[model samples]
Target chain A: MIKLAVPRGSIQKNVSEILADLSIDIPDYNRANRVYSYEFKNINDAIARSFAEKDIPIQVALGNYDLGIVTSWWADELLIKYPHLSIENLILFNDSVSKLYSTRSNDKLPLNDNLDEHIIVTEFPNITTDYLYANRTTNYRVFEAWGNPETWLNGDASIAILPEEKLTDNVKVIDSIYQGGLLLIGNKKNLKKIKESKLFKLLNEYKGLSSRSPFHFFDNKINDYVNNTKKIYSTRKQIRIAIPDGHAFRHTALALNNAGVEIKGYTDSEVIQGDLSNNVNMIINVMRPQDMPQAVSLGLYDIAITGRDWLKNFIYNYPTAPVFEMHDLKQSKYRIGAVVSKDLNVTNVNEAMEVWASQGIKKIRIASEYFGIADYFARNFIKSEYQIIPISGASEGFVPEDAEILVEGTETGATLEANNLEMKDLILESTNCIIGHKNLIDNVNPLIVDFINRFQ
Target chain B: MVDTLKKFQVIEQLFRDVLNANNFTEIRTNTVQPLNLYTSAGTLTPSMLHGTYSFLDWDGWSGERVVLRPDVTVPAAQWYLNNMEGQEAKLFYIEPVYRFIDDKNNREIWQCGTELIGISPETANEAIIKLVTELLGKLNLTTAIKVIITNKDNNLQVDNYDSLPDESIAKRLIKALGNIFDKHGFNYEFIDASQNKKFEYYTNYAFSVIANDTEILSGGRYDNLCEGLGGKKAYASGFAFNMNELIKLLSDEQ
Candidate 1:
């Protein structure tokens, strides 16, 4: 039996059209509330599943699926990090194309300074790391982000790897690394066996797609929309604080206002980056909560307001990192745990392991945004061979299909219930908290101390 | 299974007999070591560092990564600093070293190795070469040893090596090795280091004992390793026999 993995989200419609051309009909593929798995009605003894585009190469490399469709850049990212993964039969779709750009802050290009002195944030952490290592730029701290690379291009990140569309006038493009497009990849062993199969024949026939009009992201480029209009004057002793800009924004804004630690332009409706106080030493920047832990650990920021789950993940991955939680904001409470499909009748991790064992599953796949936590969970609870599938987001749809269990965080159990997944074990109960470096916590600026005191 | 185990025991016993007769003490380091021990500058090559099998420990909430012993040389230096610094010691180990060779999966190789620490450069180099040749001869395998000489000035290549300007450590090592090999009646050759440059943290000299183009053993002088591992400057040289390669060669002879 041949198993295929396809991508979901923005490129889903384009992939759907390709599947239609190949006469591979997968049901509910382009719908918002669609299940991840499906059967190929036209092909016998074949099935397909949907996953996040970044996750396709990983699934194929793990041999979980015999065939996969993913972007070439994602495949290259995986291959660059792990060159030994057996992914063969790569057929690039010429119509879909984008370029990854290494950009630098136009404001802070100190020519004599080393690359490690600059902060580089990217969604493609692996690719950025490979680029740095290839250039012999050691001693660097590259932080991972969920999305919105442009938002960090202003002050928080001095360098970034993003698409041309996400570029801003405030940054200069250094070099373009990978020119990527949608492509089909297959497991090395399985591809050899299926070369004479119908699926392989169909995919091989479409390899010469150079005649198709390329779908270029640069053609209809976005205007410079995410510019840092209000720049804080550079200061030697300025204290930088990173605040969350996504789900925790409103709660963080409320907590700041309650503490009377007010920035002029920061409110529930809008967040600001600049001096939070008229004082010269106080500076604030807005970025993803997930990037805060590493940023604080790297001393790029004096302190940051982020979720405890993110802090725990950073601590788990780098136990020697000097970042520690200074105070808990006591908002945006959630529980991070192992979630499995309720149909499996597994109330805990041990039960899930037993059921998987009975099914003759050798290596259980655990999906999570926090792989460190998932690895910790699998090692402690699941006494069996397991693999942690590091995903970007939308982890709720993983269980019972792409993954057997999900190490996820949920504010309420409603989302898990709606997705037919239940919390099998709670690993951590977390809330929004402030994190600071262990070395500088005692020597923080007085204004930052006032900000933390207000949360009390 | 029993035959394979017997062959392994025989090969190990041969190594122990040779090393023990040379007054080398046997010591085993931990199978797991902290990642930082190998990542400090000048400790490992970038390629070797990339091949380490590192993961967070159970109490890794504090952010330290532990690696399955990738190379015994670094840990040997670490072991010296931890236990017996500022002392002369001949240490040997029969331990497995884990590395990811062009793959993500852990590949464990059993290496029977020895290190001569806190000794002079020329003495340590000659002693190691003599010991390796003796071990090979005892195992009934006549081996050809290639001593790779690296000079700071890349332009220097000498047939005699003594007339090649400056009393550099490489020149001294070549003269010392030549004298020892001639006295011991050992088969050996001195080759240019640049021809097959695999100088990873080796300051002066390196050697490889090859049989039928397969490297059965290799090692070098790494004086910087001890200082890199937070110890004072100490001269050290070590070599490890690829136990698997030796066993294969032994079985083929049988």
Candidate 2:
């Protein structure tokens, strides 16, 4: 059977239409409530599954699927990092091209001269590394952010290499990396298998149609935009505070407001890297709470307000790291737990192990947004060989199929129950707290201390 | 697999015998090393750093990652700086280094290597080449080997032996290698070549001992490596024999 892997996000609709045009119809694809895996109705002995766009290349490269439809950038990202991956680009869909660029917060920090002190944050670290090496930038740390690398340009990071669309007006584009579009990639070893299958004919037809008339999905014009807007940057000695942007932003904003700390443009309803002109010594930057602890230890920030779970996760990986939760806001609390499907007929982890053993399952798959914590929980509690599948989101759908258990944080356990899953064990209770580098507490700046004391 | 391992042990024993005879102390560094040891030290190239098997351990919550030992020479220099600062030392190792190469089966390479720290480059280079030729002579593959020496300059093609510049370190090294081989009544060939991209740490020169077109041994003078790895400035040079290649060549011959 020809197993195919397809993307599940923004480009999913276009890819589904392409597949349909090639006479491969999987009705479940691109549906509102689509299942991960589906059987093709029109094609004999063929199946398809939807995965995260970034994960499509990895899954295909591992030979888990014979054929994969993914964005060429994701394919390039993987190839550039691990050049030996047995993946070949088969068909090019020139329509969905994305331009990647090297952008900076300001021209103040001369890139070449101050490279030792520069911090480059990006979603595509491999691509960023290639850019840095090509430019002879030997000294710099590239931190991989979950999303929105451009948001880090506000004093926390010196440079950001991400897509053109994500670039904010405050940042200036230094140079542009070539753009890549959607592609049909296949495993090199499985090419014979793919050619022998029914996909060979459909792919041939698609290639003929594409060559005759190049596919055009979107405008390919390069946006020659350069913003010279001067942004506020904190000196090395200035106190930088990183706060959450997504779910915890509202609560953190409320807490900061209630504590009588006025960060302009940052309110319960809205979050911003607002004008911190009033608080002359302090700079406020909004970023992923998951990224804050490490950023603080890297001296990118002096103090950060992030989840206790993230703080613990960071500490677990780097026991010697000088970042600690300085003050617990005691708000937005949740329980980090090991979750399993309700149909498993097991109440606790021990019972689940017994059930798994009875089912002859040798290795358990644990999925999590927090990989370190998942590894810790699996090692200490599971008592079985387990692999941690690091995921970004949609982790709830992993159980009963993709993963055997999910090490996830839940506020009410309502979301878990909604997905027909139940908490097997409580790993830890997490709450939003103020985490800071040890240097912040040791140096004891009176203004920083006074600001931190207000939270109490 | 058992037979191959026996051959490996035999090669290991010969290496130990020769290294010990040359006043080299056998040192084995940790199989698991901190990634910061390499990154903060700035000793490895970008390409070599990418090939390391680095991962966050169970306690790696602080975002610090560890790697399976990728290169032994750096660790050997680090060990000397930590333990024998300001002292000259001769060290050797018969260990496995983990690297992610194109060939998956060859990721775990068994290498027999030597490092001389706090010695002058000229002495260190001659001593290493002498030691390598001695070991190869012991293995009875002395006649089937070619020693290609190159410094920061000069590009010598594999087919052209006359391209190496005269009155250079390559010439001096080749002459030194020739004298060492001739004194032992051994058969060997010496050529010159360009700097290898793999030896980014090599500050002065690099040499490779090729047997049947396969580089079975390689290393060079990396004088700045000691200071680069957060240690005091000291001269260091080393070479490692690829036991996998040696075993394959021997097995094929047998």
Candidate 3:
């Protein structure tokens, strides 16, 4: 059953009207009381009403609610608060209530025509400050407002950013900027199902009704008090490191965490903690080089722990992002080498080529994670027919069992030793290396720096 | 073999004779074009764009761009807009189109199509459809020939065009009709302009011909094709045949 959490007050009425139009009847919605919970009789779903739209996101993120309809303003706030929450089904509704704009009248102040030199007042300092900075408008200052824009517009302030829809009779919009509209938030577990369900279509149709300029009419005095206290304790902490779940990555996580660093596994429990306050670092154990480019594009991991051999071969076609090597942990030492059956007479690389050439074995099948290494051998190795089969896991077991020969990366040769296969040739030796984004190298989180220092 | 060659020549001569009798002129054009030509026509999509064989020709130049043509329609429209000037033009081309497919396979498809620019919709539609019917009559096939009709506006759903975000509604309309054709046991799906043509200036009818579930011919009215290309709004209509697919279908029957 899908559990939905609806923001209380005006938004609740809008939600109820939309549900009614869809022929979805909700029971036990009290008209007088603000705190109301409703359940649909036909569908196995329940709705929880909360006054704070911001709290709706937190509840959904915590898996308390499967779905929630919150304004984009509140959704953005939640994204900042919990960056780990996967926000799927981000449908832009045409119905917009308001946008924050400058209303103060100053002949010299660039109010609407030229907002470059305007000083806008708003309680949302982070978003407003970030937006202005991104747009390259440096001459703007944010002031705290008590309630609505009407109160601030009537004041002596030269510029005040308020919701566009809520612009009063005393003020007019010189320039209108489109702020994002209402957002539908879903928990990670239900996101894929919600995307495929009819509920998604119903929500899309009702999106325009919920569209309105988001007003910032709340008291800013408390926000100012909180901001003042936050400024003093804004020191960078330990880097919060996230690792992919597995025995290998778990060992790496334990090693990093044991060295007095914050390391986490990318699972439900760790993502919910959402504490990047400590300088956070992420490590991905790449079993295959093909997975590295996609991992980097997702921007989930700050650094990936992989092999140089994989990086050199697999990253030939696509442009790779600049990476900084922190440490060569050398945990699982592997070599890109050829493996053959122990009974084979060919002992050396040159000897193996001579035997195959004399035997007229024009076509040869090789299995390996290193397709590039295999291709290199095929091109130079007496013009023999060859096909490289890429194996993901248990490549050593492929030789004399699933394949004639195998090209694989191995460390300690324990598995090869067990399989009774001998290494024919070693192309390159690889060790575990700590790599970081080049952009984040100079700005290395102090916590991450400390962790790297421990390795040294 | 010599007699067969003579017979093939006679068939070709007969086909050419019929086209001449109908006042149709055979035309051809270069199969390479600028990438923007497709994008500006509102028919360029990531899938179709990717399908076109492209290469960076930066031997002596600093910047490189894609180098092959995927569609003949866009180039044909450009030619009409440039050469015809203010007058009406009736042109046709039979050429091989290059497209990239999976497994390193490049589809070199032969297409025979016509384009009528700056003509009234009613006149253009009647002329093209009649031309197609006459062309099919020369084939002498025992299979039933079916013409599916759809309006460029109503069938294509132009209002939802912007919301689609990906392919043009006209492309989707063709794809949907293809699906319908597949379900109905038509070996080839013909996209009627009325059902799939998305360009806003297409103010008239479009159609496709199918036999044994295979689309043999397709044509449509493009009343706004000129206006979209920065030319004054002019009524346009045309149709084309998949010569290669048709040949394969006919040979397979034998």
Candidate 4:
């Protein structure tokens, strides 16, 4: 059975009208209705349910539905906010789409202003943050509001960001955060239900669809699903597993193959289309290892193969995040350690604190991509004042230029030495391992344990 | 937790007993099978293999891809094709079929189904429905159900764009399977599902026992499937009662 969430606001009428054209009808869908769902017929008919337009992306991403008729801008926002879900905009209802606009009291969204005093109210926080951060803008606290975000643009909140078409307030348009259309968006792993549905088949039946049609992502995935004749797993009950994209993907895939879990083309394909045993529905994908722990914790993925340092960094980052490492795959071994400028008079964190006291350094600046780890290490070890600076990458470039201390994971000290950096203290030794959510592990641990045993 | 496990055991045993009483011998097959067996059928229904617990079966990657058996029927068919070719087999199986719903939830579902191979068309259809009816009655579901029967001709004819459920032979067998089920005493509604249908495996007729907008039992006749897997051109029909769905029905009643 395919679960479909129909957008519930103004787009409701348009969607309902379009669905009517496709011969699928729903009654009292726009207004409140007592019925939770309506199905045209059993066995391949849609179980149409209603959800707010804003919530549809998350609902579909959570696998509550196979697909949703969500606006592209909201889909883009949720995609950014929850990157772990791998949400895809399958097809646009219309080629031309509306966009999210950043409207401010003044025409300028300052990149160099200390607007900690200012507030910004917007429905799309993640999109807005991405825009601000991309431009290196700072100091404006974001406040989330939906529908009439313009109403909150008076006192502390000087900026009102909303859908370009939705906003009628008197504010200057600064930028378009995202452009959108009514498209079919679904969780990548659970898309088989959508592909198998009459809805998808019906949508694809429209004219102008060609090999050159602008739907390579959806088309490729659909082709994969259609071609895999014997799917070993059923799409009805799903478990999406992720392998880290770089450095760890090959090792993880090898371990999975060794563990007797068959991921066809895991090590070869641009995208491996099917699962083991030849049937379908193993929702597995490759993602950056840095994103694995958070993705697993958020329930976006049931399990993931990630370096132990990433999990440690994530736990240090999100102390209350709901995830744990079930077993170590024992690959991609590395050590996260404290590294300092070669001129520092310290070989360890304790001595580094003493150096800070002797040199009368007021606050030690620790820079790392492992911000959480750096902060956690600072709280535990540094006796004097210290400020943890979060760096995106290039941990070696920071030491003497922007920071005095560096916390980073390294396999060899060649890069550190090349940059005139020396290891100060070892934080933890790490390896690639499988991590999963606390709530989800019980359901998938048996598979994980068995997969791990294949390596043994 | 203990209570749920006990309930699971009771439900499984109950299903096993029902299949046994119906003159069907239980068959056990491996949880894994060759990936090629499913694809060789050369049907659009191959998407059914979308998410198998598959891995390379040989060392360093060059090997037949294998998966934990997704559905018992295919493995059961391969078994019949290998061991009992040209022979009539009344087989029932109780096993767990794994499904990956997404990255989060996967079901290790216990499915109980019966396949009546080499049986006459009408006989196989009627017998399968009779068992399904009996099981529903046995379960004593608090909510009543509806069974919808859709003939395969109308099903395969609609949505010909995807060329499915069409075995390319004369009805081959099970031509009157729908007619036979129409005559059963149990109340059923017949619908023309030729447009936008989903029965990729059924050769002639498909039926679903639905309760509370959910399918409690469903199956179809795969007349040419045995032949596709190297068995004689025999008739086969079966249905599985999702134990979890059944328990959910009971739980809802409470």
Best by lDDT: 2
TM-score of chain B of 4: 0.77
lDDT for model 1 comes to 0.72
Q: What lDDT is obtained when candidate 3 is compared to the true structure?
A: 0.53
TM-score of each: 0.74, 0.80, 0.41, 0.39
The candidate that achieves the highest DockQ relative to the unseen native structure: 2
- Residue range A213-235, candidate 4, lDDT tens digits: 23111111212212231212222
How would the candidate models be sorted by lDDT, starting from the highest? 2, 1, 4, 3
Question: All models: lDDT?
Answer: 0.72, 0.75, 0.53, 0.61
| Model 1, TM vs. native | 0.74
As for TM-score, the candidate ahead, 2 or 4, is 2
In model 3, which regions exceed 4 Å deviation? A1-244, A254-260, A264-277, A280-290, A297-302, A317-331, A348-362, A369-385, A436-456, B1-108, B112-206, B209-216, B221-238, B245-254
TM (B chain), model 1: 0.79
Model 2, backbone clash pairs (residues 3+ apart or across chains), number: 11
Query: True interface contacts reproduced by each model, as a fraction?
Result: 0.07, 0.17, 0.00, 0.00
List model 2 lDDT by residue over A1-456, tens digit each: 888888888889888878877887888885788367888888878888888888778768767688898877788888877788899877776643667877776534422222233567788877766555444343356678887777777655667777767777777776776576778888999898887788756866775214212222132111222123222443355577887888777777667778887666665464555334246677777888888887787666778999899888877766777788888888888999999999997889889988988999988988788877888888788787888877766665678766789999998988888889999899999988888888866688777788789987
Q: What C-alpha RMSD separates each model from the true structure?
A: 7.2, 6.0, 19.4, 23.6
How would you encode candidate 3's per-residue C-alpha lDDT over A146-237 as one tens digit per residue? Answer: 23323323222344556666565555444343355556778887777766665655666653544334434232232222123211111223
The number of the candidate with the highest TM-score is: 2
